[model samples]
Target: MHTGDVTARLAELLLGARCPGCGAPGMGACAACAAGLRRMQPFGVGGLPDGLPPVTAAGAYADTLRAVLLAAKERNALGLLPLLGGRLAAAVARLVLDAGGIPSLVLVPVPSASAQVAARGVDLTTSIARTAAARLRSAGLAVEVLRGLVLARRPEDQAGLTRIQRLANRAGAFRAVGPPPSGPVVVVDDIVTTGATLAEAVRACEVGDRQVIGAAVVAATMRGGGAR
Candidate 1:
């Protein structure tokens, strides 16, 4: 097969011709699913999940948005990158423009715990952040991604934990891998559940005189497990 043919076949195999939202089998989510996903209003700084900074979510973490995020983060749905990536970039842009107050910005993704990375075989949050940063750069914005943060100590997953519980679990968990960057740094993540993880990450990023600009995420759990 020619290169173009091979590429097309790969796209078909990866993205399929159906929608993930409705199982209609044509380029993933169908029009209804797409519309449902869009109904999730993008929200700004409020009660965010742990290990993040002042954050924004593209939509509530339910229904189509939840499905898309799980598919991307757990099921290895690389095809959804363009969709989720666009949202992530939009969140980053909003933070940089409003909360961070920095013209040129740097994106720093909160490092997934080592065990989680080993399980997934990919850093989903970091991947999304890199994609988002590229989109920002394409729009003539100065942006760079620096994966210079890591969990100082491994901890339990915050899945069922309360916000306070999550906060305690993630407190003092992150540390810089080296001297941090000079430009404003926005901590990026895939979701905000209880604002605990994001808070811990913000504290770590702000340590050592590094200016933590803000936080951004693709989604946030809404009205679930006490998420505001």
Candidate 2:
């Protein structure tokens, strides 16, 4: 294990973990909550942004999954990384394999602003992408995480924003950095709400001739069955 990984595990152990889903003590997420989270079916969100890749999510953003994501992103609950990452990996695997399985693929995580990373004490999306890459590798699929997209400028947080507001805020907000990944790319994010962020990410990647196969997320907010 890397030194950082070892240190993080030690920290989680010393902190006396609590299950984010049910507030049960003694584990980051208890087995029951884990099982509940695993009861996920991949689905797409309504009103997807224009040019957004076909997206898939491990589950709906509700109940145990929502709680776990909140704890992981808002509270620095690093212990939840493995569980969340595993779900993300599974979602991505399904997307790629259903398309006939590539020999290797790249995961492009949506970038978080520097301010957000500082406030959270971690780059949440990148960390999850790294973990998800590891899980995919272990499952015998070659995977690489290419952080090729960067924010052109920091924008206001998406919280409380309507769909149009979000689309406006995120449009033209990302740019490709350095050489783009050479293989099929799957944009990864922690959540897919209106998909404005992922759409921008896909746009940025495509700017460099990178072929984005699809997108994957840990969860998606429920919406009407058809395009809104």
Candidate 3:
């Protein structure tokens, strides 16, 4: 195992498993916190960027979901992976059913920057995508995860950028790492903020002639009148 993995495991063992949402000691999220996360809803980008594929989120990025995502992404709260991944799987299932129930689909996660991954010791979105793929396979759907996208260059941090600024900054920021899949490609992401990153991902896949059906995300931030 990598030193980082060993350290994370050691920390988990020492700290014991506590709910990221409630801090209650147990395995993974507590029942009450899990119940709160059960409220999955479809969301759309309000000021949807051009070239962005149709995207649907499983739930709003707030409350317990927000806490859990932050814990998983920023704090190395690995226990929340299963719950978040299950939510992503549910979203992918819905999208497949809406698209006439394809027998199989390829899921491509939006890649994180190399520097960020080095610092975090894990690629949060990719890890969740893998877990989501496993859940989908268990449910009898043929799911394939393609790590096809990579950062063409590191862009500025997107913490507080406006939609237009984000779009400009992320333009041409991603490129496909290999030949794109022939079947439908669904970009999976942890969050859809301004839809810029997902839009760039779709563009990268299309560069290799991949048919991007849509995108699936764990959560989305509601803006304007709310997601459609």
Would you estimate the TM-scores of all the predictions? Answer: 0.82, 0.88, 0.87
- Stronger candidate by TM-score (1 vs 3): 3
Q: lDDT per residue, candidate 3, 96-200, as tens digits?
A: 877778888899999998877898888888888999999999999988999999888888988888888888888899999887686789999998878888888
* Per-candidate local distance difference test: 0.74, 0.82, 0.81
Candidate 3: Cα lDDT at 105: 87
For candidate 2, what is the lDDT? 0.82
lDDT of 2 by residue, 60-87 (tens): 8888999999999888888899899988
Please state every model's RMSD to the true fold in angstroms: 4.5, 5.3, 5.8
Candidate 2 residues lying further than 4 Å off, grouped into runs, are: 1-17, 225-228
Q: Give the number of the best model, judged by TM-score.
A: 2
The candidate scoring highest on lDDT is: 2
Q: Which stretches of candidate 1 lie over 4 Å from their true place?
A: 1-18, 30-41, 48-53, 224-228
Quote the lDDT for 160 in model 1: 75
Per-residue accuracy of model 1 over 1-228 as CA lDDT, tens digit each: 776556545656776655566665445455677677655656685645544456777777777777878777777677777778778888877776665356688888888766667787777788888889889889888889988788888878677777778788887889877786878888788887777777777788778456886778888776553131
Pairing residues by index, what is the TM-score of model 1? 0.82
